[model samples]
Target: MKTLKIGNTTVDTVLEWSGNLFDVGAFWPGRSWDAVEAERDWMEPHFIAPKDKSKPGVLAASIHTYVIRTPRHTILVDTCNGNHKTRKTIPPFNNLNTDYMEKMAALGVKPEEVDYVMCTHLHLDHVGWNTKLENGRWVPTFPKARYIFAKTEYDHWFANMNGHAMDGSFEDSVLPVVEAGRADLVENDFAIDDSIWLEPAPGHTPGSVCINLVSGGGSALFTGDCFHHPIQIANPDWSTQFCSDLAGSATARRKIIDKICDTDTYILAAHFMDPTAGRIVRNKDRWKLKI
Candidate 1:
């Protein structure tokens, strides 16, 4: 649990989690055989392999939604896998636990207090908590917040996929907000207020956007799923097989690393081990997470 003042905003929190395979596998469609091999080839040295759920594998980072306190609004970036989310192996997220909300309250922010809700991409986890079960209806989680999304990302993911049947995210996480007139879809480089803006870091997901903040001599980049683990900082080219384009993801990593390293900005990774916030340092012509 570390914090960074990014740009004109304060990225106060990043929640880490651990769960069954279903919670993880659901995101990376081809996670089984390929991901295991990935663990052996690149992840083992820098990470710990999970023995079971109680001792969940660390590589599948249990990280989520970042709370950014901006000058004009309190923004939340990329809500993580939510409670009661249906999956293959992992039981739906903590159906009985109200801690996520509790944590928000402790920080003096209820969903209603959030002025803007921005998502980097609309993966199941990224969008899971966007809506909640209200009297048997899956309704917008942040009742008063405007849910901002990238137009390209929305269209690409909202489009039909190969084998998976689209669940009602279109209905629950997205459409309901739109129907309620709470959604604000914009281009990849959309700006919100002054201190915050979207960085179009595509490839992990077609419309995957990164949130960059700058203010008061501070800056940070909220990298959502661009590089899943700190291990990626070392082997930036080794993308998961499930990535939209492995080569493209690698290229994106190098490009992002170059930009951030050239600056004095702290990185807000959506996933990684504890003390997730760090500076991307160039170690002998290689990038490494310097926590």
Candidate 2:
């Protein structure tokens, strides 16, 4: 486990899994490795897997949750792919099991002790852990926590429940929470306290948000899918195929780069590999994440 401090708050990562999961070309359609060849030095082995003549270039990614402890609250930002869920479209995440809860226990926090469960969006991977299978029925994983969801984001998925576009997560992982009355559908700009709040960062999903945390003199942004890989730092215009709105996602990516570039604020991207938290800096005319 890796711990980070933002002023008086403490943040830790509960990793589900990580690896070179997707081919670079397929992840970002039409984008080639040459576009980011200049960054091969730092990208290899983490962001971009080393090249192999037997296969296409692949991008490294991690699925995990951030456990944030403020002076007054214990918060979890984006629940990673939960265990035993069926993700038909995303075969990599289907009906799997892992020691995710044990990892949380090692951090000295139990599921019931969590004060809030915040989802950046309602995507399958981001919300899978919202519920767990118990006796063949899905139930809220955090028995006593309030699960927060953006109103726009929730409504979008809620209306499309009849379909299976999201790999059946809307029904299995999210609905159970809502039916249990543990869901909080708030505006995109909802705030939790003086040090934390939500900021609208649409494009990846209509209701996707960036959770902002400011305390004492330290600051960090939990960017959910804003930039899946560090390569986006240099190529802000390359939106992944998963983004609901490609152009909007690209614009949001640029906005995030502009907000953190050459600054002390840390970026905790959802899918970035190890040493996932870092600051964006200017490299001549391009931007790079200094981890």
Global CA lDDT of candidate 1, please? 0.69
Stretches off by above 4 angstroms in model 2 are 50-55, 162-165
Q: Candidate 2: lDDT of 200?
A: 96
* Candidate 1 structure quality by residue, lDDT tens digits, 1-291: 555655556676646364333223444443443444443533443333544322342244655678888767888988776666554433444342446777777777888888888988876667767877788877888989989999997888667532122244455566667777888889999988567899888878778888888888888888887878766777677666446777777787887898998468877777665556778887676667776
TM-scores of all candidate predictions against the true structure: 0.82, 0.96
Worst 10 residues of 2 by lDDT: 48-57
Local distance difference test values of all predictions, in order: 0.69, 0.88
User: What are the runs in model 1 whose C-alpha is more than 4 Å off?
Assistant: 14-16, 19-60, 89-98, 161-168
lDDT of 2 by residue, 44-110 (tens): 6556656662135677689999999998889999998899987778788888799999999999998
- Model 1 clash pairs are 7-213, 7-214, 7-215, 7-218, 7-219, 8-214, 8-215, 17-62, 22-90
Clashes of each: 9, 0
